[model samples]
Target: MQGPVVTARSARPTVMTDGARRHLFNDRTVARYRHSLSEGVDRVAERISGADRPFTGMSPQRLAPEIAAIDLDQPLGDPSAALDELETVYLRDAVYFHHPRYLAHLNCPVVIPALLGEAVLSAVNSSLDTWDQSAGGTLIERRLIDWTAGRIGFGVDADGVFTSGGSQSNLQALLLAREEALTAAPAGSQLPSDRTELLPKLRIFASAAGHFSVQKSAKLLGLAPDAVITVETGADRRMRPEALERELARCRREGLPVMAVVATAGTTDFGTIDPLPAIADLCEQAGAWFHVDAAYGCGLLVSPTRRHLLEGIERARSVTVDYHKSFFQPVSSSALIVADAASLRHATYHADYLNPARMVEQRIPNQVDKSLQTTRRFDALKLWLTLRIMGADAVGALFDEVVDRAAAAHDLLAADPRFEVVTRSHLSTVVFRYLPAAGQDHERADGANLYAREALAASGEAVVAGTKVDGRHYLKFTLLNPETTLADIAQVLDLLAAHAEHHLAADERRLVRR
Candidate 1:
């Protein structure tokens, strides 16, 4: 009898007996997590929105040592504890991109409308792999694509897919171009040789000012990095059409096949837009695929005033647009649109068990059919809701505000004797530096200015990024926050100039003593 007796056991997870609903997913844990998220969002909006810190750098891997021993399978402490931890360890670590003083790089403020959509989509976990799973989600995403194509004046049948961001969009576009080359060639033929010999002279042309992504794309496409021929740009950073033509001729003389002409609607450093109309014409005459990396400038499509910047974007066979950049959506809102949707037939793959169309009639978009992704997030929800709530006019006007702010910063810097606006505002970015006080050495002062930029960022009170152009290092201010003001930028310049003067004067005294 004593041997047959059982010992007391610990509590187990509650299993509902008279179940009205059996929770298939971890609803309790998930609900707790969501509540915590909302609280953290509120706290962040309240406290840090007005705080002037450049960034809060926290990393999950950094927390591995602390929580590594815990069993994550078991439910985390109810919502309150989770939110507090998220706030302390995760959110506070991110750079408050919306801050007016955050002039680091391409990151920008998150629009409110889009933020709400993000929350809903995340909760729904809508997978856009097929129309059956997506339903209205597919329709909404398709509508967004159509709206963007219409803005760019694409042909009535243009097609597109939402993406994580510009880099992925660019990758997909190049992949499509590679596929086009393969499918267009003779049947039973092998892949075109990436070498200059077999497919020798296979060339991918882009402006020197274009993003490095194009070169990476070429390399990834089996065309070696050397295949990316950097065409010369004029003083304005726009690819000189004449120079592009010269490169094309040189490639042909050497027996290289021109594969594609990649143009930039917005150069990364200078925000310079290549004359797309000219580039499009050149690509047309040469019979090369035309692709435009319009990640930074495609928002101009909605801008009635600045649409002229992209005169021939519609002529491009494919285009990349980052909705996060100009539309104020959160990070990872981007799309790749093709003028001819059928060209994507090259990317289509057949499967029986997963997406077999043997018995069913496919609808307008079975997104998996036309994307680089299969289990895609409902990212289109944010952009779609953003456009729905504010419409195109509001979006365009925000862009105009950024442009005006850049101009304001440029004029202010140019007029000041101690500061120099190196380049006028190109879109929302300005390149400038602290000009040494008169009797100060410009060469020595330039170096000091560069040093000051790094120093400011290291100080952590305020951060303005730095970059080099034409071999000279310069400080760069990318104004993306609408809440930013002239005074804020002026303060940043004053801090940098003062820091430079201090360092430069010390250097002069040291030299004199020597």
Candidate 2:
């Protein structure tokens, strides 16, 4: 093995030779990063091509000791040796989402065009915080934002900024809504000397199926715990317009300010879209801000056939779209778009060292002025590259294929006697649980279903997710992989049934022993 390369000719630090400086800096000529980058890519490619399963099925107990043995104080000093150690320590056991059997979360196998953009963006290291920091990069990001706004059918006054994820986007949206509400309140309604008092009378409304981030945002915004009022849902798990209207009327009678009404375009577990048109009308009548969390369903913007699902979305004052979820892009590709661009001024913070007022007067585009983050990544490149190469229609087709597969899988589960499938999929998720045998009660059924999900995950032949509906445990199939077929889902279902049966048999044995 090659030892560490040393070029120091003298012991004194200030008396460095030309070769030592070159080696330390690792410039183009000295370190040959081109070769190093190629090697790293090749290592990951080899790992992907050689993997036998989606996961290694290794328990944390066995992996912890191996990871703890690494000595961080001393460097490995050799690139090839470090790569070998990385392969053994991390890559061998990492959960590969690209595998056909992995249907756990909203994670999608990234597209090739996005990968190309990632490579270039990382190499260039452009920060989209200010216009001077990233001249052309700023323009590219703004142009992409404009294109997204146009697709959402927003008017000419619409504007937005990219965020870290759906959570951040939602938080920022609520912040703007709160600011807008405070600005519009009658004089003396809020004590300017003590604005915290207004939090008590402020309220936000969302469906029972809306993202948990709604309540989280309320908490973060210093509103009371009861500030978020969850409206009722019908049999379809969508928000009932009558329930929302009644709640709005009560808020008015109680002197509570309806700050905002959050509508979900696609929920997390069931993928159910709330009644956006009715909700929009209610918000308009109540004079409350309307926000749509379309993080998981924004892909329908380009979906040729399913575009009607997002009909009333354009009416939202602000909208959250996570391109990473449904656009086949990698993580952290989400934006918070607003219908009225002036609402974004609530997030602006003027700093003399960065985005100054002078720059704004000059009409120079500084993304930091509209973003919650100061130093943001150039994530727009990923979507730009995807649109340029694969075209938006191709991406939409892939999403449509997954939705179609999800429908077929729902039928397969519903037809099976062993499973009690939930409602028909509205987007691309099928919520269901394993049904116990005829003699078992509700408690036993829940236990058996929970055990089946846990056992399957431990076995690692297939990875799935679990959630609770109506206070009972249920498993979920979040189908985002277009390549995954019905056979794959059938095999996974077979595994789940076998595991549930094993758990029940073991429980019976325990009872007999007792």
Considering every candidate listed, which one attains the maximal TM-score?
A: 2
Candidate 1 per-residue lDDT over residues 38-141, each given as its tens digit: 77678777756566676643345765665566567765535567666666555656667777888878887877899899988987898987877888998898
lDDT per residue, candidate 2, 421-451, as tens digits?
8887678999999987888665777888888
Superposition error at 103 for model 2 (Å): 0.8
**How well does candidate 2 score on lDDT at residue 375?**
90
Off by over 4 Å in 1: 1-34, 56-76, 183-200, 357-364, 438-441, 509-514
TM-score of each: 0.87, 0.94
What CA RMSD would you report for each candidate? Answer: 5.3, 4.9
lDDT computed for candidate 2: 0.89
* Model 1 steric clash total: 5
Question: Each candidate: what lDDT?
Answer: 0.79, 0.89
- TM-score of candidate 2 on Cα atoms, chains taken together: 0.94
